[model samples]
Target: MALRMKVTYLDGREEVVTILPPIFMAAEKHFKRDGGLSERNKVASTYYMTWQALQKFGREENDFDAFLELIEEIEDAEDEAEDPTGPAPQPDESSS
Candidate 1:
């Protein structure tokens, strides 16, 4: 089954993206195994990754390559917020 994500963009626009639940679960597992994310942050990270993956896949085929980039950006941002030493990675303009 697929999960849906309500995405709110910086431009004040909102949309829903559908993602396969297994993919989201895998991302969550990865975050937990990495040990870089807190308990709460790990959940949020999976959600963010799922949303980005859905958004990337929903768009044009060209966007597939940018999905990972967007995921990295979201993770980095979360890291920065939790730790000052961590700088937020910027999202790929091509995907955004």
Candidate 2:
């Protein structure tokens, strides 16, 4: 399955970025030299994937640190794509 995620920027723009093999290969190089992709390194995998997606998709080509600063949120495009709960229930206004 494609590793898809919704990337939201600080400027309020949101995009659905797909992580392809090129992105994974790059991450593999980086992590192999730094830390292997063990379960503990899941965050590293996620961030690298997001960064590469942003760059590869022409969304933002900044270096990783700069790209990190631009991201406001990261959500799974697959799981939340069909949120069964729907929107979070609003607080009851008549309670008090």
Candidate 3:
């Protein structure tokens, strides 16, 4: 599935930006490469990596501030997807 964000340009034009699953997966590896660094550095590195990755999908470099919102949305969705408690509980068959 693709995740998309709507950007409203300064000139009153609105456009939808999308990131496909492949790009997201590839970008994650680059983002994680700085895992050994301090939190501050990691945040900066992650933003840079995200910027670079999105650029490949046609996002403008000058619009990084808008991309920041998309990045946060993607990360939040990822966190929710990886959440263990998010799945439905299975039936217990212990008494069978």
Candidate 4:
């Protein structure tokens, strides 16, 4: 499954990109490895994953630091989206 996420760059720019399954899987593996998500590994995986995902969409990111920043924001956004804060109640609009 491809994960479509909006990434915000350090320059305050935003982009919607779909991360392919292979890249996502590889990043997941690296994130959940034996060391349990070290900073170095996380940065590496995010950078590589972002690079691959962008390339798949015909985008190029040359600044390593900027790429790292963008991926970190993407990760943060992903975490927020996956928060188990309970689902919101639906409105009863049927009577309208």
State the weakest 10-residue window (summed lDDT) of model 3: 72-81
TM-score of each: 0.40, 0.71, 0.36, 0.46
Of candidate 2, the 10-residue stretch with the lowest lDDT total is 77-86
Cα error, candidate 2, residue 79 (Å): 4.7
Q: List the residue pairs that clash in candidate 3.
A: none
Evaluated against the true structure, the overall lDDT of model 1 is: 0.51
Model 2 score (lDDT): 0.79
Q: How high is the CA lDDT of each candidate model? A: 0.51, 0.79, 0.51, 0.63
Q: How well does candidate 4 score on lDDT at residue 95?
A: 79
Most accurate candidate by lDDT: 2
- Candidate 2 residue pairs that clash: none
- Residue pairs with clashing backbones, model 1: none
Clashes of 4: 0
Point out the higher-scoring one by TM-score: 2 or 4: 2
Judging by TM-score against the true structure, name the best candidate.
2
Q: Model 1, 65: alpha-carbon shift in Å?
A: 15
Error of 2 at 16 (Å): 0.9
Look at candidate 3 and tell me the lDDT of residue 6.
Answer: 45
How big is the positional error of residue 5 in model 1, measured in Å on the Cα after superposition? Answer: 1.4
lDDT tens readout by residue for model 1, 1-96: 555555444445444455566566666575775664367676556555555565566642324344434332222232122233667788889976
In model 3, the runs with Cα more than 4 Å from the true position are: 34-54, 57-96
